[model samples]
Target: MNQSLNRIAAMTARYYYILRSSWLRLLEIVYWPAMQMMVWGFLYTYLYQSRSAMADTAGLLLGAVLLWDVLFRGQLGFTFTFLEEIWSRNLANLMMSPLKPAELAASLMLMSLIRLLIGTIPVTLLTLLLFGFNIYALGPGLLVFFLNLVLTGWAIGLVVAGLVIRQGLGAESLAYSIMIVLLPLCCVYYPVEALPLWLHPVAWSLTPTYVFEGMRAMLIHGVFRTDLMIACLALNAVYLGIGFTTFVLLLQSARHKGGLLTMGE
Candidate 1:
């Protein structure tokens, strides 16, 4: 048990050392999320002023944006940390260490949480100050919703990381772009029903779809859809399981093929 903890700790420290050494990386954690919030927050404000149908737009849109970032930042946090090792040529060193795949994943999950907090907290507070919107108003279920989205992001990140591990940097671009493909399917800015009937099943398959739907329901109708929340949680668990298994298999495959050593070259 202690050995596993140490492995996880060592992996976490490796990334922490990198983050501490670079001011730009630290600044980047906060910059992009804040910038995105500012742009969308203003657009949401404009819609509120211009559209009677959007009278209560601030809470709904801001909440959706913030929640969406939970997923985005979570995935970026995990993949970027993994990619950083690749960029610094540290992947080989780490792979050669006593660390196990599960331990490395545990470390990445912790790093993702840290990055998610660093990236989202400032923007969340800014929204409260500038727009007088508190997403927490969605109530206790907010925590569950946030976890569901973050887990979903982690699942996707793990898949991307696995692909990169097995296929090398050729697959690295998926780390940044996977979420974009997932965004529309997630129903972030709109309801699932707004999508074509054919895509409804696809949207529903992605857990965040239910999460955002639940968020809109809470904001617009003062209704908390526990069923959606439950579904999201269950789906997240399944996806997370699949993601972790895939990552471990790919890492092992890479080790067998000497892909880890080649990655640093």
Candidate 2:
């Protein structure tokens, strides 16, 4: 166990070194946030200015934007960083070591989590600073919501990483494509009330919506909304189970086919 911890520490330091490269740091601190702000900021403006105004427009949009971006950051960091090892032809060198695949996966996931937090902290503070957003009213429930979202993000990351291992870059694109469909259906910028009644149940089943609602309920209204919190927790578990299972299956298959070692070559 001590040996495994050392390996993870080394890998994490390597990733941090890569992250500190001036170009990547600039992209993370400036380019990505600006692009996201432009797109989601526009939507936020529309939501507030129009008569068909969104429910808790500022909070809903901000929460949605933050949550979705964190999810993207975590999943992409895990997938692309692992893929980078392959692109650089260094994966085999690492594979030759005593490190197990599960340990490698865990270490890569830790890097993703770190990246997500770095990106998220800045954007979250910016949202509050620039948009007058406030979640403090949510009190301790805020922590619960944050944990739920993070777990959901990690679950998504595993599936994304697994698919990239199995199908290469095309699978990477497909993994992201799922987000395009999910963001709308998740009711990030809008509420389930805005969706067709037929879609309400489906939207509620999605974990993000529950987190969003729970945030609004706790912070905006000072209500517990235990049902929403419970729902988010349950859905998070389901996603975690599905994602981890799929990841293990695909990873084992990839190992058998040498897909893990040969991808990006």
Scored by lDDT, the top model is: 1
What's the CA error at residue 71 for candidate 2, in Å? 2.7
* TM-score, one value per model: 0.95, 0.83
lDDT of each: 0.87, 0.72
Ten contiguous residues with the weakest lDDT in model 2: 53-62
Per-residue lDDT of candidate 2, residues 149-238 (tens digit): 777777777787777777766776755566667787877666679899999989987888887776556545678888988878998999
Model 1 agreement with the true structure over 231-264: per-residue lDDT tens digits: 8899999999999999999888887887688694
Q: Which regions of candidate 2 fall more than 4 Å away from where they truly are?
A: 38-56, 135-137
Name the lDDT value of residue 166 in candidate 2: 71
Clashing pairs in 1: none
